[model samples]
Target: MPFAPEKPARLTRRRALAGGAAALGAPLVTVFAPVSTGAEDQLAIRSDILNVEAMQIAFDEDFSTLDVSAWGPGTRWIAHTPWSGDFGGARFANPGERSPFRIVDGNLRIEARRDPEGEWQSGLLASVDPDGNGFSQQYGYFEMRARLPEGPGVWPAFWLIGKDRSTATAEIDIFEFYGDKPDGYSSVVHVWHRDGRHYSRFHRNAVFVEARPDAFHTYGVKVDPDWIRFYFDREFVWKTETQPEHRQPLYILLNLALVDGPTRDATPDPSHMIVDYVRAYRLD
Candidate 1:
């Protein structure tokens, strides 16, 4: 079953990046309104149709035990490859381990480090067989608190996958950042598989406030039938409303990748994407 590179996805990385300059800041981009009255702190619930419930948790060592159940049954733990080593590959780095994934000191630390073995690759961990996860949701609120890694070519992202990885039904990138651009983070929504490929339709919104790589910021996504919204530090940053396949069940994914091909940069010796907590919510 040879993969046909020609298959039309809802969007491709190239199409999304080509128009990157123009789409960097669209009106749809959410400008953080100063944290207002107490009412704003409440979950923005959709009227009558459904009552949205907020699932919340603060990560610490105790959480490691509870999260083990979230992965589902028969899931195998995938470790970073040896060639990549603990520092990751040429484009990315993870400290403590090659893939930057670990549980220690009461937190899930996704760190990158300079390749001790001189293998400067970054780390990546996905559901062994994402399709078999047997879990996907049509609409829900997803959130995570993490400390990002900064360095050139380090791409860290918390995103989603459709039942079929090859054909894109929809991909909701909650947050993606590069070490080069330290102050800003990006949020995008993608619907792949069409020929015209709505690549340019994908957007990138900025976080005007500084996001220090060492501190924890809550990154979130609120997905409903009509719209998908992104948030940082609990503030809205961007959204996509014209969802053609919003009803499909989309699974979750998180990874730190290096930019490939000719324009690659000097891989960071060691880098890490430390995630403090991840939570999912639904209508109560």
Candidate 2:
């Protein structure tokens, strides 16, 4: 489910009317075409692997504005996780003037810093709320292009959570970066039933790739019926068997978190994770 965004210098979002299909649970994509500003949407993901026309854009967020509201009826994003489980060393703060989210130069800056009360605060955005009022898809290509913050105790991630919680909770971690280990990141697939069942059969992959502090990089996952494929900067990196629990509509979440453990150096007072875009695509 997508809402059309204003055309900034970097990307253009054109909306198409979608009513009947939306009523039937199909959310239309706010179609996007790349602008000359940068390599934001220039990646050709599955042209050679699958039919080009088979995939259609489902969701797109260039973060022109932080469209968030309370965990109620009508917001595109909820500030915290739907289950009220706020993770990491830093607290996930509410959206406000002193909030961690800021739209700077057509990008979303998720800042990790201390509030006036001397408590650490950061940002997290989820596409779905507890009432199931936002966007979620069973299978698609989801991605985020971002410039990570580097320093001790800083943690950033882009991940997904299955919407149905009747039996189990499924998670697909696209990438989780620990600033303490700036040379690489990790991808994990997890499933845990309500009664603490089916937790061991999952994939935990550690990807070894050096990070350039000044440049932005892309991290993504293509979730199909049989496979969950990961990509770095449009280059395929890893894959695993898609779990049965993961075959349901899953919501998106991206955040800047602080590590819970101690580190050698001080955490950056005002660290930031600059996100260019978070998007999704579904194959026909």
Candidate 3:
């Protein structure tokens, strides 16, 4: 069956904290006035979303420094057509000196640019390192604060894959944004079997926002034994009971890709996806 992202509910201070805490199996602690008044108060609300009880900080990458120990550069990703065909136009390139991926001002920036030969080159980062050393978890809450790029042909995504890539692969897409659809993004889950079969589900939703795609927003997902939930900007967006039932650990992947879509011809020379942070928490 096909799936689409439902329109998100209007996020209120009370709802954001209370709902998120409940989802994490935690109790809400702070009480706020019906109408919040200052920047300090707003910051407090945001903090609660991250520090919910019954959850332990498993992995946190602020990108304050380019720590290759925690994240592997582009060499960890391979350049090939997605799904075994030459469909997507962009080629994933190995990391070089400021070529496609970089760290600046405490943020990790992944850019899609045209090479000197006029070929599309972009950045892809993975939790698995080139030496086959990396991090993965069975089930947890994963979140990323990022600002996406705008303009045609640009695609930025944060996703996870099972540790075993050879067969029966499991994947979870936290968020995928297309520049052409400036107001929405997609989330999906897939379980690919070794016999060339697959089970897939997806949700594409239009966000209610006044800012452009460049504005920073939080995208998150909670994976459990029987349920998978998604959130945008700390607000609950969607939930599903049909899960991948993945038993092995899963690793993270982030990329800025170019696809053959309506916006391809109009895509700008350089498009970027700026990431403020990526974090994971283990459920108690």
Candidate 4:
């Protein structure tokens, strides 16, 4: 439980910074190629398998109402990870009157702020609870549309982990945004074997890209038998070979966490990530 897809600071952050916006100009026509001969932008669906557009929405949460419980049997979401591994600087609080989540208009706002005693508290929502009750799928397209909170000490992310942990944990971090680095975020895939033998330093992956401030954008990933592809606003960014360890169904998780950083850059008094939706899709 201690192992998670955090920053990967020493191994990949520097490489990510150096990677820069290399994915800017080139058209990374991955799994599905946009083969438009002339005018309108359209894609030529390969004869092989599935594409994002051709998939059916299996789960959708617009946050119209909060159907969450601290831990659940019938609730739509749980307040903590199923493994009970709550990382980052702030405490992932349970759902209560003082909970750090709210529905503004139709969006879910995850807040991170200090308590009266100066301790930080924030929100985390997992699609599956400790008892393994909730939505999960073998392979699918998972996405979240949101605007992240900027500035130092804030850490927000959307990620996935395989359901069966009897042998290992297959984690795919869709995105991890560190406020200090406002222009980009991190995406890592980890295979945490029970013995810590497969959790190698070389397994950490990261990326850097442009994320305009205060604007809502889509962050997504497509998981298939061959590769795990990442996207920003539907634009292909990167991919990795699908790990064999990811054989079990995977669940969704998102959180607004704080980094225990320098005192000079204390967490914003009240910071939040406004997420418009969280949805998952399966091959139609």
Q: Which candidate tops lDDT?
A: 4
Model 3, CA-based lDDT: 0.65
* TM-score, ranked from best to worst: 4, 2, 3, 1
- lDDT (10s digit) by residue, model 2, range 105-170: 999999999889987889999999878879999898888999988888887889988888666667
Q: Ranking under lDDT, best-scoring first?
A: 4, 2, 3, 1
What are the lDDT scores of the predictions, listed in order? Answer: 0.51, 0.71, 0.65, 0.72
TM-score winner among the candidates? 4
What's the CA RMSD of model 2 in angstroms? 13.5
Clashes (N, CA, C under 3 Å) per candidate = 34, 0, 1, 0
Per-residue lDDT tens digits of candidate 4, residues 141-168?
8999999998777888898888887766
lDDT tens digits, residue span 1-284, model 3:
11212221233111221222332444333211122233546644443343345689888888876544223334324332223222245666754554576888889887788788887788766776544455678888888999998877787888877766555557788888877778888887766554444466667767835756688899998777766777888776665554544656777777787764445568888888999998888977
Report how far off residue 275 is in candidate 4 (Å).
0.5
C-alpha TM-score for every candidate: 0.65, 0.78, 0.73, 0.79
Query: Over all chains combined, what TM-score does candidate 1 have?
Result: 0.65
In candidate 1, what are the lDDT values of residues 192-247, reduced to their tens digit? 44333433234444563554765778878877787677677776655556365555
Cα lDDT for residue 111, candidate 3 = 76
Query: Which prediction has more favorable lDDT, 1 or 2?
Result: 2
What global local distance difference test value does model 4 have? 0.72
